[model samples]
Target: MDIFTLTIIVSIVIYIFIGNYAGRSVKQIDDYFVAGRQAPTLLIVGTLVASVMSSTVFLAESAFTYDGQMGPFVLFPQMGTVGYIYGALFFGRYLRRSRTTTVAAFFGERFNSHRVQQAAGLSIIVALGGYLLVVTQGAAILLSDLTALTYTQSLLIAWLSYTAFTLYSGSKGVLLTDTLMFLLFMVATLLFTFYLVSDLGGISAAIQGLSQLEHKADIASWHGVIGAGTEFPTAMDYLIWAIIIDISWGIVFAVSPWQSSRHLMAKNEHVVLRASIYACIAAGVLQVLIYGIGGFINLANPDITPSESAIIWAAKNMVPEFLGALLLAGIMAAALSSASTFLSLVGFSASNDIVRPSSPKKTLNLRATRWIMLAIGLLVLGASLFLPPSIFWLTYFVGTVFASSWGPVAFMCIWSKTITASGAFWGMISGFFLNVIPTALQYLELIDLPSYMDPILIGAACSLVVTVLVSRCGHVSRQEKVYRMRLHRTPAGERDLKQTKISVIAPAILALYGCVMAYLMVTFYVTPYQTASGQLLPNGQVDWATGEAFLSVSWALLYIPLALLTYILIWRSYSPGAKNIEQAQTKA
Candidate 1:
């Protein structure tokens, strides 16, 4: 084996070993389900980051950045950073405080209805299923290209191996291994990236050359800077309406059932909050590095297509066999980490949501749960075999489904106290059709727009407003109504919270991102990059100036001080709700 392949194998083995060791106490449901609620902040951060920054970021974004107006565009990073902020401020701590095993439990408790549990359960199942499809599709694509393996063989091999792996250790191993895999993947990729960039001219030389090229190839504007381009390829905003309209879809996950699955694994609220902050910082860095590196590769090559192939092309050409293998392994690691967690969460939801049927005799049927998980594995395995080859397109369809259905309901549940079960049901159902069905039709080319953000924006808005209107106009529960009244009476919490749905730090970071964005925007407008011979290169050949390196440094400066304060707050919170933090906090 090459050194990189050997490194990857050794890394996977070590992670499995770590997982086995950590899971020595897996004797019951609690142990298997939530790591016995003993997860520390670092593990929480690692696992959550691993889950979020999957192959989608590495391969799909790498490929798509080419045709995109700006490499990866600014929206991807902005949404990711802001999404984590929402999770931290709006969802994470509350769910931790709510003391629920599953986010579904939170919905069930808050809505005083079994259907809400069903809602949480169903949403997670779909998300996980979509996640599995993404994992298998990526594995097939990567292995088929990288190794001698055929696509089918690679997909099957991956599916079977992961199935065997997860069956043995269940979620306990998932937790431990995800943590280890994330660390390994990050280290390997970052080191490989450092070498790759250094091998290209130093950072400054690379940037100066790229800036010159940017002058020749402005795809968004033909003759002038702001001149509009054509349909499909020219339209930069794929999900413009969704970004503005359905911000909640992205925001809800930090605490909703899909996201809360990762959070509830923590030992306490302190861990949850710290992990949230960690997500924000990690997301910021990931955005700049992945996007900037793609731009850098294009800077060297000049003419690339589709943009998504940036990582794949970089692996073959720029990187040597050994380092390339490690990058590939890191890709594998991202897929595995996300898929396993997705499967575990889905399996839990199936048993809890569909089959088990909430009852007084609820022992959580450990054996039944295992069987349900196996059944889910089989279904995913089948999909992996028969499904389309590209996860890039397919997973988004799944994401659209989840984002539309659960997205609206979950957002209101966390941020708005007035949402009722009836309202949630009607609104979410409407959002689902508006978001997913139309998007799917568009993807199939039965329609015009790729993914008009308008439906989601409209749906989410209507859902919340309608949910509130229905709740208020109809027979509202006295106790729930009273609680909301009391909460509103405490205007200190409301006023302190209203403008900043995210944390205090979010506004600052956004302002910073804004300033950076303005500078880049100005550069794009005023200056055109040039070749040494004064030849204007094609669009792919040009690049935005290196804003990423600066963003990374800026993000660090902002994160450190805020993190220290977060730590102090957590110390105080955890001291009162000591040892059995998850349960203790729940009870209190």
Candidate 2:
């Protein structure tokens, strides 16, 4: 086998071995489902970032940048990163306090209702099953490219590789292997980014060069390359579309099963908080660089077919052989990490919440979970084969499903004293169907909705309305009231004043970094554009009016406010003098 195929094969073998090694320690249901609830910040952060940075990031998103939609693409993930902070403050710590193995179980216990738990579980399987299918197709495509095999043959190989380990080790294996894979891909990404930037004559030259290219005019602008036949026909159109979908993605990061479940694996609420801070930084930086790489790949070869394979193609042709193989392996690592997480959660929920809820047999529960995972694996494999691959759109569609269905309910279930179990259940169902039905119909070409009436926006609004209206009809139970109050109680052991102070420092530093980034943009991007007032456009003449209009409303100005707001919010919630900390310490 050539280096590409050989590298992927060896990587698969290593992943399987690591999964087996981690599996040896799984003795009970907790060990299998939540890593015995003892994962540290690094491991939790690894899993949190790795689990979400799958083929969706490496392939689907990269394609958007490659196709010159970098402006909207970048905005979405930056907003999503803030969800880590939101989740840490409002949702994650409460989930940990509930001491539940699954996110659905947390809902079940919080509401003191088994039906709500099953509803939540059913949503997980449906949403994440579709997500798993997309991730699988991503890996299959990568495998097919490297080995020159048919899509079906590559699909089986990719499926079996992730399934073998996920089936054997469960959460424990997924967490450990996810961390290892995270380290591998992160290193590879940094190296590849550095080489690509250098090859394109550095960032300054690349930006300048991209600006002068006629066919890709306005590519480096905030709206991307908007015009006839483009994704966004005007700057306002791009802005409206990006903001709605971007906020939905932010909700996904905050409340989605795959993302928030990592908090359930954390050793403590502190670990959850710290991991979110770290994950926010890591994910933001990694995605920004990946989008840049995607755009940079276009500078090298603009004719990449399917567009999703731009990164894979660039790896083979743009870099050295060893580095090329490493980039391919990194992409595969990203895909596998997310696949294992999604598949493991699906199996965990299916057995723990659906097939037989409240099983007293811990050993039996563990055994049955593995079998269910295998069954889910086969089902996803079969479905992936039939689904025509629209990698980016499929991922975007499935991912945002949670933003509407689970987002409102997830937070309200934690903070709203008036939200009843009946409300929560119906809210999830309403948000789910309302979002899915319209989006699917639009996908089928039956109807067309304007950008403002996007399915996610409408569905999220429906969920919130239904939840509040339905909540008024029911009474909050004593158990539910007590559970909600209990979630707010700060445990004595978490009261490390020094650590809390240190944690507060991170947000402050992030705020400072945001200012610095904004300054860098003004210096490198804005100043250059301003100086190019006389630079010829595609028509071989300057359009000073349009350029001046863009400069008046630069995206850079939004950074400082967003960053400072994040810091203020984090400080109020996380400072040592915060109500929870002060109240608990005084009692102590």
Candidate 3:
């Protein structure tokens, strides 16, 4: 076998070993489901970043940027990171307080309804099952290309590798293995990106080169290669699509089963908040590096076909052999990390939420959960063999299902006194079906929906309307009211003044990093457009008639610093000092 193929095989073997080793700690369902709720900040952050970044970012998202859509594509992560703060403040803490094994259980317990839990669990199975299929195909695709194996053979290998460890080790194995994968991919991506940028004569010259490319004019502009020939015909069309999708993704970050569930594994409410703050920073930095270099790769080799293959192509042809092998392995790491997380949740929900409510026996529940996980893995493997991969769009479609279906209901469950079990159950059901059915019909060409009428918008609006209406027709019981109040009350372990002060430093650092990014964009991106004055584009190669788009895009980055500063203020209110005052007022 080639060095690249050998490297990938070795990595998977190591992960399997590590996962089984960690499995030795599993003594109960909690250990299997949430790492006994004792995970520290690093493991939580690792899994959070690993689970979300997947091959979708490495391949699908990179393809968008490679095709000169970097301007708008970057906004998705920008908004998504903002959702992390939302989770820290409004959603994740209460989830840990509920002390549920899965996000589905949180819903069930919060409402005191088994049916609601089953409904939430079913949504996770269907949605995350689809997501699992997408990421599995991603890993197989990577392996097939890097090695001599056919797609089917690679699919089987990838499936068994993640499944074996996931079944035996459960969350303990997955968490430890995910952290290892996270560190591997992160270091590999940074190294490859640094080399590529230097090769293109640094960021300044690369931007200038991108502006003058004959076939890809406006590549560096805010709208990014827009025209009649592109997927987005007009600037307005592109901006609207970007904004809508970005907002959906923001909701995904806040409440998606995979992302929010990581908080359930954290050691305490403080770990949830601190890990989320750091995870947001890590994801933002990595995406900017990954997506930022996507368009720049075109400067190195413009003929890369099937833009999804852009990253793989660069690894083989643009970098040294060792670095290339490591990068390819990193991409596989992304796919495996996500696939394992999705598959585990599928098993967890199927057994814990769907089956456990009926079984009621501990041994039967454990046996059913493992078997269900195995069955789901096999099912996904079969699907991978036949399903045509559309990695980026498929990932987006399935992920947004959670945003529409769960986002509104998740937040309301915590903050709204009027919401009832009926509202949540129906809201999840409607939101999921409304989003899925319309998008399916549109794709089948049975109906033509306008570009502005994205199904995500329709489904989310439907969900919100139905939830409010259904909630109005019902009443919150005393039990539900007390539960809500308890969630709001501060946990004794979380009321630490010293830890709060320490946690503040992370956001403070991120706020400063945001300042640095804003400065760099101004110096590298906006300044060039301003001085373009026709010299940078000597042959009228420049696409824009003015610099408005450039200036607006550059200045918009300031929102990051502004948002982080605001978050720091909110985080401080969690200090014991603030909690004591609130408690005194309540007593009064």
Computed on alpha carbons, the lDDT of every model, listed in order, comes to 0.60, 0.82, 0.82
* Candidate 2 Cα errors over 4 Å, as ranges: 72-77, 355-364, 529-578, 581-588
Candidate 1 local Cα displacement, residue 81, angstroms: 2.2
lDDT of 2 by residue, 236-313 (tens): 877788878778888998889999999888998778887887887888778878987888787888889988889988
Clashing pairs in 2: none
> Which model is ahead, 1 or 3, in terms of lDDT?
3
Model 3 agreement with the true structure over 337-416: per-residue lDDT tens digits = 99999999999998888754444554434566789899988888888888798888778789999988998899999888
Stretches > 4 Å off in candidate 3: 74-77, 356-365, 529-573, 580-588
Task: Give the clash count for each candidate.
Answer: 14, 0, 0
Reference-based lDDT, residue 230, model 2: 84
- Candidate number of the best TM-score: 3
Decreasing TM-score order of the candidates: 3, 2, 1
Displacement of the residue 324 alpha carbon in candidate 3, Å = 1.1
Residue pairs with clashing backbones, model 3: none
For candidate 2, give the lDDT of residue 542. 37
TM-score of candidate 2 on Cα atoms, chains taken together: 0.92
Q: Model 1 over residues 439-512: C-alpha lDDT tens digits?
A: 66677878765334444554556665666677676654666454333322212222222222333343445445
Error of 2 at 523 (Å): 3.1
